[model samples]
Target: MKILVVDDEPDVKDLFEQRFRREVRNGEFELAFANSGEEAITYLSSRPSEVVLILSDINMPGMSGFELLRHIRTDFNAPPPPVVMMITAYGDPESQQQAAKLGANDFLTKPLDFTVLKEKLRTIA
Candidate 1:
């Protein structure tokens, strides 16, 4: 499985790499990083079918995750659209509601719990 993680923070790539190292080493999954929503959009445009899942931070500079979710739900026309999971620092009910309204498959709060995430991935896989 290929998972695209979108976040504005530069350290996120390293963090995810470290967290999912076992999966990567065993060829269970591949990880890709995009710094912002625009970058993610560009990546999706180029390889619409490659990514099976997207883990996106809700608060970003250029484009918010909600906007990205809207785009994923409305703009992307690829078959079997990638499952989207929204991550936010603030676990506010409004934000959760917005994410659900925008069609997110799941919602996660940072600092992400990889144990739970791994289980979620197992279910999806």
Candidate 2:
């Protein structure tokens, strides 16, 4: 599995690398990082068709995850990646519903619990 992680914080990317290092080491998964939604989209758009999942932060400078979700839904009219999960510190009901409406596969709260997230990914993977 290839998981494209989109977060503005460099530290968050480092933490994710730390957390998922074993998976990468074992060759079970590969991870990529994008600092913003636009960069994420650009990276994915130009990729060699290998991304299976997207883990995105909600609030971003250029494009929010909600808008990114909308963009994927609209732009990927045919076959698209089936897994796109939103991660946010601000997890309100309204935002959750909005994310769901925008076609997010899952919404995860910040200070993430990797155990649970892994279980969810198992279902998708």
Q: Which candidate number maximizes TM-score?
A: 1
Candidate 2 lDDT at 63 equals 94
Q: Which stretches of candidate 2 lie over 4 Å from their true place?
A: none
**Candidate 1, after superposition: displacement of residue 122 in Å?**
1.4
Residue pairs that clash (backbone atoms under 3 angstroms), model 1: none
TM-score of every model versus the real structure? 0.97, 0.92
lDDT of each: 0.93, 0.84
Q: lDDT per residue, candidate 1, 1-125, as tens digits?
A: 99999999999999999999999999998999999999999999888788999999999998999999999888774788889999999999999999998899999999999999999997887
Positional deviation of residue 81's Cα in model 2 after best superposition, in angstroms: 3.0
Distance from true position, residue 64, model 2, in Å?
0.9
Looking at model 2, residue 81 earns an lDDT score of 49
Worst 10 residues of 2 by lDDT: 73-82
